[model samples]
Target: MQKNDKIKFYSCLAPLSFLYGIGVWLRNRLFDWGILHSEQYPIPVICIGNLSVGGTGKTPHTEYIIRLLKDKYRIAVLSRGYKRKTSGFILADSESSSWEIGDEPFQMKNKFPDILVAVDTNRRRGIQNLLSLPEKDKPEVILLDDAYQHRYVTPSLSIVLSDCHRLFYNDKLMPTGYLRESISNINRTDIVVVTKCEEDMKPIDFRIIEENMKLRAHQLLFFTSIVYGKVKPVFPSKACFLNHKNIGKEDDILLISGIAAPAPFIREAEKYSNKVVPMVFPDHHMFSKSDFKKLEAVFEKMTSSGKLILVTEKDAARLKNNPLVPESWKNFLYYLPIVIQFCNGQSFDETIKKHIITFSKNNILQNKYE
Candidate 1:
């Protein structure tokens, strides 16, 4: 939605926002006062989350941390597995699909088969289950995806991500804006990362944001931007992987996504193809035969023979599993993968490594095992 459109739409619902804010405030206060206990464990627990309802780039940031420490530590990733059909704790295995363990967890499992991936609505139980694995098989470090608000298990390190384009500072409470909690709650975070930033973001812009946030001395800040990778087939056939430059300027790209933010994907696709047609859906939308038919109609309308369908990796997880999706369409469909690139990577990397290292030295689990 455009800024002015969001402002108008939210303004109409401003009254409900007051009640929503109160509920969030009370919950936070309970946690703050110890009325609601937050459990702490001996081993290091790192959490990556956001204050907004969606579109903060938490998944990529969590993946970045995993990539950083996976070699040195026996890492496990735990999530609530939003929108999954099953309940209770479930571990990702050969049988797991996007439907069984949710798209993100399934994607993570596919990407990092060596690491432990499990999901439970009750994060504390999930942690306990992970710890219960045989002594040698137990994870030394746990990466909690999107669990900052859970508060039941207190993470050793908390990193809160805020989108550079749609910052928490500029947002309001739920019904009024994207923020799930007040911006002030960011004070609880150990690190604040500004994500989806431009590659050439000005230092003055950083200074302006820092001043606006009024961050505490204990809190560290960093900036990162998205780096798109080559577009590859969703299902292997005769289709060859193609980079943006290799794709013909005359090719008409059909961009399909069911994500909170499709603007970035759309913007990136336009750079690769002269004629880009977008087919957007609500976040985490389940595809039906009707949807596929609509997509086919759009594909048929394209005049250029050099045509392709593009999707995000997360979307690919859902689409690849749908039974209604035709095999013919799957051959034409490709998904773009993305990674987070820190603006000042050296400092970010050093700080994260130092914190984890320091925790390892001081943690009781490390002492016992070592």
Candidate 2:
């Protein structure tokens, strides 16, 4: 976290990253020489992925794509289902829980009940399963979560997301730094999105990011933000939504979250309630016996201190399905629904729509002939 400590850390990773760079070169060479083949999907596959490990807001962007295309196209989302137990292709259903389908997929399924969602370690198999389904069930466009480094399949349109606060150009690969691949790999992306932008990004600041960024011939940049949901109240007995009348009338607010990045939730929670009791666990930490007990203790403390419990929609995504959350916090707990919003407004929408539609149409025709 400190400057000298970080320098020492990257110092260790530098040599290992150099070796890792060699491996990547060889792999790309094999594919280039036509020995190792890249798989192709029948339909247009747009990948929303990143180079880093956590907190780029890909899920919100993926959800945004789902929301945008739900009415027009038969859309499906494919994820590696990181940290999930299962190996084979798993489609989320009404009966599906986080344990079975993973956190993000289940959240997507719950958000857009009409859309199809699935997860698999082997993406090709997942695509095969979707193709095997009836024509009407087949997706016209499939969104792959965290597939930027996946060279096995060639995505029709690849959108690489980077945090504006923590751009890859400023950092290095992990062990060495935090990059998954080399700066040259940015060439693979069609569009580069600057996610989680500060609301008041200046023109000069935008230029600094672009100038430092390792860009290919036509790689585009877009800025986005987390659009927080409306502030609501916690009732005692029934499910009561918040309105103007009961804005700050809640007893107190308790913030609980389990996300790779809990900053957004904490910031938003603080905006509504100054006295917030925050409960955060590790990312993707499934509830264990002790974990549940800890949460119970935290809840008890909050209640005793006269605070109502509130959680991110993501934490609630898993907890609402499970029995870990006690009946006491059940009525009080709430989750925030976030969506990726472009700061530039219509210009951003137009650019994304233009590129995707053109890419989809062109890829469709090309695949039809091939």
Candidate 3:
């Protein structure tokens, strides 16, 4: 499918929303009645999710929180393993490949070895398994990636990240628009962060977003940006070089991205490279033999001679698993690790800390993540 198909736009299916609402209500009823079950992990669970469609910066934000809490707490990250070939709670290992766990979780495992990364389509089962891990490996808290819709496991702190560009409050439910749930669901979030802001974003932007959003009584609002700094080339054997500053410092970045949106990647790439050539793909696109040959041929033509190839951290996760990547090309293929740091710095972390503290004090973060 093309990129536009993935975008949540207003649909003519609004008449079926009554049916949609019924499905929503019945699903909740099942869990509420214990007919369908919910599992509470034996540790604190913090979830970063969006009520709408993609581009809320959930992954980077999740990585940020995980890194922040790792020093003081043993943490584990659980994701649905969204489009993997496998289906089960597969724990991440240095030896574990993305084929079994999918790219995102595998990427998480590679990025944070100290933390346990688990993937399963059934989120309820995933959390249960994590909680069941040995005491030493048992995390103080579990970070559920993209789990706001997984109603089975109730997180202690539910952080809802929204885009300043698109607020759910102004949108309609799925198929009708981007919203996964009704805008009223904002009430469920403990905090709302307007992600992907400009470095010099004015107060007017924040005011515009906040003014448009229908905030709940308990939800706190904040803004954040992508602090792009350096880009490192990925090689099969761990062989590479940088130009005093870094790789991708030169012009002409050919960006190969299989993500929700290529906009952010393009924007970041332009900063380091003179121009960006985006080879966009459907989210979680599986590379085919024909596709590989086609892309390699394209990359070969782009480079022409000297080393210059760049891929996002997500795409690199998949590439790392496949042995097909030539050792020589590995050194040329660059990947940049991005963290969602606030425009200022400590304020966002501090805000999260306060919410975590509150959860602890209220005993809400206890052994019941369900």
Give the candidate order by descending TM-score: 1, 2, 3
Specify the highest-TM-score model's number. Answer: 1
Q: Candidate 3 lDDT, tens digit per residue, 214-317?
A: 68666778888877646665664575655515534444456788877678778877766665678888877776667677777876666434346677788888
In candidate 3, position 10 carries an lDDT of 29
lDDT of 1 at 31: 91
| Pairwise lDDT winner, candidates 1 and 3 | 1
Clashing pairs in 3: 40-370, 235-330, 251-274
Q: Give the per-residue lDDT of model 1 (tens digit) for 1-370.
A: 9999987887889988888888999999999899999999878899999899888887888889889888988989999988888999998887788888888888888888889999999999999999999998899899999998999889999999999999889988887788888888999999999989987779999999888878899999999999998888888774676677888878999999998888999999999988999999988788888999999999988878779999998999887778888777765789999999998888988988898778877885666879
Clashes of 2: 6
| Per-candidate total of colliding backbone pairs | 0, 6, 3
Residue range 175-244, candidate 2, lDDT tens digits: 6767787777788888888988887889898888888885766777878888887544332244456532
lDDT by candidate, in order shown: 0.88, 0.77, 0.76
Which candidate, 2 or 3, would have the higher TM-score against the true structure? 2
